[model samples]
Target: MGAWSRLKEAFTREANISSPEDLLAQARGMRNGKVPVTKDTALRNSAVWACLRLRADLMSSFPIDVYRYVNGIQIEVPKPPVLVSPGGTEVGMREWMYSTEFDLDRGGNCFGVITERSGVIGPDGRGLPGRIELVELGAVAIRGNGSTITKFIINGAEYDPWEVWHEKQYTVAGVPLGLSPVAYAAWVIEETLSAQQFARDWFAGGAVPLAELKNNAKVVNAKDARVARDQFRAAVDDSGLFVHGMDWEYKPIQAVASQSAFIEARQYGASEIARFFGCPGDLIDVAVSGSSITYASMTQRNLQFLIMNLGPAVGRREDAFSRRLVSGPRFVKFNTDALLRMDPEARARTIGARITNRTLAPSEARALDNLPPFTEDQLSEFDRLFGSRSVPAQPTTAVPGATP
Candidate 1:
């Protein structure tokens, strides 16, 4: 057939046409539509398909688990909660939860909360209870001010920070506590996370690879560096429980760092809470002096808050938890023998002190460092290796395990 006839046939062919004319016309149409089907596009499409096919392999290259989000950024898997006592056998909840916040300054060290909450059974199943409302607890507001009531979703779980506060305001007893939608969403995600044997499983499904290349090199590079910087900065920034900065807020990658840093800080902070609040030196002294330990109720309440943050809602331990109340400074005790063995001078100061305040002085902070303990030299070495100018100190009123 002639070129024109072939072209016509290709354009209106009932059967699928394989003519070169058809290819040319198709190209023209694509061009008119502002689509560039260049070699780069082909190569990018091929690469993306290949990566999607071998995502598990690529993820396995890293030391930790990596998750790719809607935005083309990868975040690490959040740290799983560490269970107490039976250790790996029991699933202990995390002591503190971290989240992002909007800082008006929009620069270094943004505002966020390290929250503590407790679970109690009312008419319904075990639910979070008391002045321990989710709203009053420290968390970033998604839609309103810090004080405003709103819903927040973290890792797919939905929670209403307001509902908890409302219950508190009304003093509604046995309100049959329920997880907010955000919390419920998070609960689903958590269940999925738990069921998956490997982190790569999350991205294993039907994510279509893009055929056209959109060169997001700048955004991708910026995100990677920003995330790295946030993680590094959190290690350095000594402001709150989880050190975060707003200089480059929610840069996608930073979310990963923020989640991770917050989890770690809260985990480490739990022991400190146990030492400071669980068993304050003053309380110990009072009990030893043959006086009624009046702080017992306070201790139970504090422990209730701490345990709520870390304990499972229903289980073998549930009844034990409900039967006994939380109180005292939930401070994890240090072994004096171990301290003395580690540092004679630090030990001497620890032992020589006529009274232990449970309140840590700047110098004596090292005393309680016994549980997962670090010595002065170790802390110094950490600072040197990590290039940190300051050491983390707990708030005096925090009572170790209390959510600060």
Candidate 2:
């Protein structure tokens, strides 16, 4: 098949399900007095969106490398073209990782079709994919008999397991599918969305009157009451003064305390969503009450974030990539050293310290900054400025007043 044909086969918009059912259910009325919560509806909530986006954003930033073991040693190799442009030449590695990571973060799984394969075949009787095109989560369905997925249905077309690329997280025993944190946190999301809608509607003419105008002297006739109501509404709507004679009373209304706290409730909901997604509340910009963490430097902060929040997910993705994208002892690794990179001043201090202690060579340190090793003339100038690195005479002559 041509590349265009393969691309066509690789991606389809057909979904295993439709989204309007949730929308209709919500529109007709509440389901059991609560808004229906689905992936689509849940994303409308800012907290959920932020939590998922934060993870995907960070996941895509880490560069991936290919490595293989040789004689008890691991060495990095040039990454395959598929890793550089999985979706297409038009889609770079960062975009591909971002798209898949977004799906994995939101749904606990990511699905793609292997559109092309290499000429070399591995022991598994299948070649590594040369191209993989992801489709919408809605476009795929899983068929399993409890223990493992038996079939993959993409765009209403069935395919063998080998043709599909699937990665799953948040898994449990005896279940082929990943358990979605979004699905499990539906109640919190729904409550948050509902609160947002309530506040929106209240501001948009859904609340009780601001004040009631009443006459104490006499009961007004319907004709006069209608005229008076219109006059009052028209005056207030224009923010004009409502002039009235004696015997008229305007009683202002005050909202109950509960109704005025949805803003705070939304903040709390953000913290909850962050927790559900295993994201540090601070990393995702959701503040946890009575919790404060301090770090000495950016490297330390990023290290903590990687270890606590992103380490497991990164490891899981690395495993998936190694299993599916390569063969034999070859493996995939994410370059998290980029995350620990410090500012120039601090980096210089660190490398200088390492070189002084002989833990690292000056040439190796220069390479870390993408610089070539010092030339002979530069080395001679360095020797003059800061004494030679050659060891001092082994104190063959003991210190004048020291014990032997």
Q: Residue 270 deviation, candidate 1, in Å?
A: 28
After the best TM-score superposition of candidate 1, give how far the Cα of residue 369 lies from its true spot, in angstroms: 14
Q: What is the C-alpha lDDT of each candidate?
A: 0.29, 0.73
TM-score of each: 0.17, 0.82
Leading candidate by lDDT:
2
What lDDT is reached at residue 137 by model 2? 80
RMSD to the native, candidate 2? 9.7
Question: Cα deviation in Å at residue 187, candidate 2?
Answer: 1.1
Q: Relative to the unseen true structure, what is the C-alpha lDDT of residue 16 in candidate 2, on a scale of 0 to 100?
A: 31
300-336: candidate 1 lDDT, tens digit per residue: 5334433442222112122322222121211111111
Flag clash pairs in model 2. none
lDDT accuracy of residue 229 in candidate 1:
59
